[model samples]
Every structure is written in C-alpha cells, then in structure tokens.
Target: MLLAMDRVTSYYGKTAILKDFSFGIEEGKCLCVLGRNGVGKTTLMRTIMGLTDRSIGDITIKGTEIGSSPTHVRAKLGIGYVPQGRGILSEFTVRENILLGTFARHDGRPDIPEVCLQMFPYLKANLDRRAGLLSGGQKQQLAIARALAVDPKILLLDEPTEGIQPNIVHEIGETLMTLNRKLGITLLLTEQHIRVARRLGDAFLMVDNGRVVASGPMAQLTDDVIHHYLTI
Candidate 1:
C-alpha cells in the first residue's frame, strides 16, 4: 500500500468526527470517499494530512509511520493535499505558488516541479499571472498544480468538482484521470457528487457518521446503496 490509515479516529473539540476509520490506497488507483454533507469524509482526509487532531490511529506511508508527523513533514514524505478550496497564493504568481511545493523535499523528486505542467497545461501558460486573477477553474488548477509540484506519492483531493462549471469539472476529471493513469499516482478523493465519483474512481469507500459503512469496487455501488448511504 502506498498509504494506509489504520484504526484512525479523530475529534473536533469535544465532538468526535471519525471513529476507527481505516483504509488503504495503492499507487495508480483512485479511491473515492462518498457520503452526504458533513459526514467526516473531509475529516478523514484532514487526519491523514495531519491537519486535524487524531484521537487514535496509525498513518503509514510506504511502511513509514507518519501518523504523528507534522503536516509539512508529511508533505516532505510524499503526501499532497488539495484542500476543499483551491489553496493558491492570491497575491503571488502561479509559478511562485508551485515553487513552494518543492521547497521541503529532502530527496528531491524530479517530478515535483515539472509534472504539474503536464497534468494541467493551463498552469504552464499562466505561470506569470497572479493566482488571484485567475478564474475559479484556473485557481483550482493552480492549486492542484502546486500540490503536485512536490511529487507526492499520494494525493488527497477534497471535492475537486465543487462549485465549478461543467466544462471545468470535465477538465478536472480528465486531469485527475491522466495523473493516475500515466504517472501511477495514488488518489484519495472525497467527492459528494456521484457523477464525478463514478468517472474518476476505481474503488469506493462509503463513510457515514465518521465510520466506514461500506466499501468495494465502484461497480458494486448500486443505485439503491447510493440512495441509502450516500444521498442526502
């Protein structure tokens, strides 16, 4: 497994968010976490990135115990997170935002700086443009690019299709597909929209009330199951 979250548990203040959550992701596979609003899908990803307070669990990346590692340290160990909102530098140019991703790598994965351009070509053209000046789709592209700049083995994406136009959503889908197919990148995506998840994921994990309710290949997720566990 490229990434493994074993018996992961998390909390927000006094409220528990995740309860014994566990999952594994391999390189070149897309694992989609599906649930309705506020069901801890994002919390699970945040915990893996070490952004949230983990109640208990072990996060292993390529056999390295990274559950307790800091967010920046996890990034250096090949974990990239594209947050719910596109997290690009509003004032800085696109190039600068991407360059920041390469700063932490001790091993210096060559794919860090250049591969993002291959994934989202628009970023290459808009290198000189300020990230804030770009459209929502463009900003999202830049955000994904920045995360890729560090050449992460596992990419955790939170709602790539949210609040975007259909054309841009299609582009995001294609971009994600290309990354996993050609580059053998592992993807752990949290998506609310069924259409996006259907197209982008190879495996499916259904999380509800902070626990793994059901999971299997995307093909096995029937309409009835989705209506019960996923639909709002």
Candidate 2:
C-alpha cells in the first residue's frame, strides 16, 4: 500500500473526529473519499498529514509507520497536501508559495520543480505576483503546483473543487487526471461532487459520522449505496 490507516482515531482538542477509521490506497491509484458535510472527510486528510491536535493508531506509507511522526517528517516521507481552501500564503508571491513545499524535500533543493511550472503556465508567467490576487481557480492551481514541488509519492487533496466555477472545476479535474493517470502519482481526495469522484477515482470510501460506512472499487459504488449514505 502507498498509504494506509489502521484503526486510526483522530482528535481535535479531546474531541475525536475520526473514530477508529481505517482505509488504504495502493501506489499510483486514485481513491475518493465521499461524505456529507461534517462527516470527518477533511479530518481524515488532516490525520494522515498529522495536522490534527492528536491521533492514535497506525498510519503507514510503503510499510513504514508514520502515526507518531511530526508533520514535517510526514511530508519528507512523500506526502503532499493541498489543503481545503487552497491554503496558499496571501502575502507571498507565487514563486515563494511554491518554494515553501520544497522545504520538505529530502533533496533540500530550493528551486521549484520544473513540473510545477509546466503544469500551470499561468503561474509560471506570474511567478512574482502576490498569491492573494489570483482568482479562486488560479489559487487552486497554485496549491496543486506547490504540492507537486514536494515530489510526493501520494497527494492528499481536501475538496479540490470547492467553490469554483464549473468550467474551472472541469479544468482542474483534467489536471488532476493527468497527474494521476499520466504521471503515475497516487491521489487521495475528498470530493462532494459525485460526478467528479466517479470520473477520477478507481476506488471509493464512503464516510459518515466519522466512520467508514461503505468502501470498495468504484464499480461497487452503486446508486443504492449513494442514496443511502451520500444523499443530503
């Protein structure tokens, strides 16, 4: 497995958000986490990145335990996160924002990877522009680029298409598809759009009330399962 959580229980200030949750994604595959609001989808991403207040259980990347490792260590172990809301630094220029990801690179190289620029021509053209000034869609592109700078084995994206225009959403979806399918990067994303999940994911994990309610190959995500767990 590229990433696996074995009975992980994650907490935020003593309140457990993910209760004994467990899932795994194989190398070079896309896994979509499906759930309604407040169902611990985002928490699952955070837990794997070690961003929650605390967590207990086994989280392994390539058979190595990272449950107790710090966030930076986890990043160095090849986990790239494009957080919810596109967590780019408002004060930093586009170039600076991408450079931040390189901090976790084992190579310690300060230069942004050429792949990051190649993937987003707009960002490459406006490297000196302040990140805060970009449109929501553009910021999202930057977020993915920054994550790519880490040269990760697995990418964790929390709501990668949230609050964007429909056209931009499609474009971002295509970009992600290329990353996963063409470049062989593993993807683990939380998505509200069932269409996007169905399109991108090879497998599905349905989350509800901080638990895994259903999971299997994407083919197994029948309409009955969707109606039962995903309907609002």
Candidate 3:
C-alpha cells in the first residue's frame, strides 16, 4: 500500500473527529473519500498528514510508520498535501508559494519542479503575481502546483473542486487524471461531487460520523450505497 491507516482516531483539542477509521490506497491509484459535509472527511486527510492536535492508532506510508512523526517528517516521507482551502500564502508571489514546497524535498533543492510549471501553464506564466490576486480556480491550480513541487509519492487533496467554476472543475479533474494515469502519482482526495469521484478514482471510501461506513472498488460504489451514505 502507498498509504494505510489502521484504527486511527483523530482529535482536535479534546473532541474526536475520526474514530477507529482505517483505509488504504495502493501505489499509482486514486482513492476518493466520499461523504457529506462535516462528516470528518477533511479530518481524515489532516490525520494522515499529522496536522491534528492528537491521534491514536497506526499510519503507514510504504510500510514505514508515520503516526508518531511530525508534520514535516510526513512531508519529507513523500506526502504532499493540497489543503481544502487551497492553503497558499496569499501575500506571497506564485514563485514564492511554490518554493515553499521544496522545503520538504529530501534533495534540498529549492528550485521549482519543472513538472509543476508544465502541469499548470497559467502559474508558469504568472510566477511573479501575488497568489491572493488569482481567481478561485487559478488559486486551486497554484495549490496543486505547490504540492507537486514536493515530488511526492502520494498526494492528498481535500475538496479539490469546492467553490470552483464548473469548467475549471472539469479541467482540474482532467489534470488529476493525467497525473494518476500517466505520471503514476498516487492520490487520496476527499470529494463532495460523486461525478468527479467516479471520473477520477480507482477506489472509494465512504465516511459518516467519522467512521468508514462503506468502501470498495469504484464499481462497487452502487447507487444504493451512494444513497445510503452520500446523499444529504
């Protein structure tokens, strides 16, 4: 497995958000985490990245235990995260924002990865522009580019398409598909749009009230299952 969590229960302060949750994604495949809002979908991604205040249970990446590791350690272990709100530094220029990802590089190279620029031509063209000035979709692209700069073995994306224009959402989905199918980067993403999940994912995990209520291959994500766990 590229990433696996065994019985992980994540807490923010004293309140538990994810309870006894376990799931895994294989190398070079995309696993879509599905659920309605406020169901701990984002918490699952944060837990894997070790951003929660505290967590119990095991998290392994490439068979290496990372549950006890710090957030930077997890990033150094080849986990790149594009947070839900597109956590780019608003005051930084595009170039500077992307440069931040290189801090996690094992090679210590500070240069922006060529793949990041190639993947998002807009960002390449506007490297000097302040990230805050970009449109919502453009900022999303920048966020993904920054994460790719980590040269990760696995990328964790939370709500990649939220609050974006429909056309841009489709574009982002296509880009992610290329990354997964051609470049062979493993992806774990939480998505509210079932259509996007169906288009991009090889596998699926359904979360509800912080637990894995249903999970299987994309083909096994039947309408019955969707209605039961995903419909609001």
Candidate 4:
C-alpha cells in the first residue's frame, strides 16, 4: 500500500473530528474521499499529515509508520499536500511559493523541480508575479505546482477544484489525470463532485460524520451510495 490509516481517530482540542477511520491506497492509484461538507474530509487529510491537535491509531506511507511523525517529517516522507483554501503565500512570488516546497526535500536542494513548470505553463510564465495577484484558478495551479516541487510519491489534495471556473476545473482535472496516468503519482483527494471522482479515482472511500461508512473500487460507488452518503 502507498498509504494506510488503520483505526485512526483525531481531535482538535478535545473536539473529536474523526472516529476510527480506516482506509488504504495502493501505489500509483488515485483514491477519492467523498462526503458532504464538514464530514471530516479535510480532517482526514490533516490527520494523515499530523496537523491535528492529537491523533491515535496508525498511518503508514510506503510501509513506514508515520503515525508518530510530525507534519514536516510526513512531508519529507513524500506526502505532498495541496490543502483546501489553496494555502499559498500571497506576498510571495510564484517562484518563491514553489521554492517553499523544496524545504521538505532530503537532498537539501532548493531548486524548483522542472516538472512543476512543465506541468503548469501559467506558472512558468508568471514565475516572478506575486501570488496574490493571480486568479483563483492560477492560485490553484500554483498550489499544485508547489506541491509538485517536493517531488512527492503521493499527493494529498483537498478540493483542488472547489471554487474555480468550470473550464479551469476541467483543466485541473485533466492535469491531475496526466499526473496520475503519465507520471504514475499516487493521489488521495477529497472531492464533492461525483463526476470528478469518477474521472480520476480508481477507488473510493465514503466518509460520513468522520467515519468510513463504505469503501470499495470506484465501480462500487453506485448511485445509491451517492444518494445515501453524498447527497447534501
């Protein structure tokens, strides 16, 4: 498995967010986490990265136990995260923002990976532009680029297309598909859109009230499952 969460529970200052969540992702496959808003979709991503106040149970990446590791250590272990709200530094230039991901690299090199630029031409053209001046789609691209700069074996994306224009949403989806199919990068993402999930995911985990209610191959995510667990 590329990533696994075994009976994991997490808390944010005494408020329990996830309850005994268990799931796994195989290498070079995309796993889509599906749920309504506030159902701990983001929390699952945060818990895996150790951003929660406290957590219990096991989280392993590439067969190594990362349950006790800090957030930076998890990042160094090749879990690149493109968090919800597109956590880009507004004041930094596009180039500087991407360079930030290099901090987690074991090789100690600070250069932005060429793959980041090659994948996002807008970023290549606007390397010196301040990140704050970009549009929402551009910012999303920057966030992905920054994560890619880490040269991660797996990517954890939280709503990568949450509020972008429709065209850009499709574009981002295509880009992610290319990354997964061509580059063989493993992906774990939280998605509210069913079409996006079906397009990009090989497996699905349905989260409701911070727990995994149902999980299986993407084909098993029937309309009934969508109606019962995903409908708002």
87-130 in candidate 2: lDDT tens per residue?
99999999999999999998899999999999999999999999
Return the TM-score for each candidate structure. 0.94, 0.99, 0.98, 0.98
Q: Is candidate 1 or candidate 3 better by lDDT?
A: 3
In model 3, the runs with Cα more than 4 Å from the true position are: none
In the range 8-46, model 1's lDDT, one tens digit per residue, is 889887778999988888877999999988899889888
lDDT computed for candidate 1 = 0.85
Candidate 4 Cα errors over 4 Å, as ranges: none
Which window of ten consecutive residues has the lowest lDDT sum in model 1?
Answer: 104-113
Q: Which ten residues in a row have the lowest lDDT in candidate 2?
A: 223-232
In angstroms, the error of model 3 at 163 is: 0.4
| lDDT ranking of the models | 2, 3, 4, 1
Q: What is the alpha-carbon lDDT of model 2 when measured against the actual structure?
A: 0.96
Q: Residue 230 CA error for candidate 1 (Å)? A: 2.5
Candidate 1: stretches off by over 4 Å? 108-112
Model 2 alpha-carbon drift over 4 Å, by segment? none
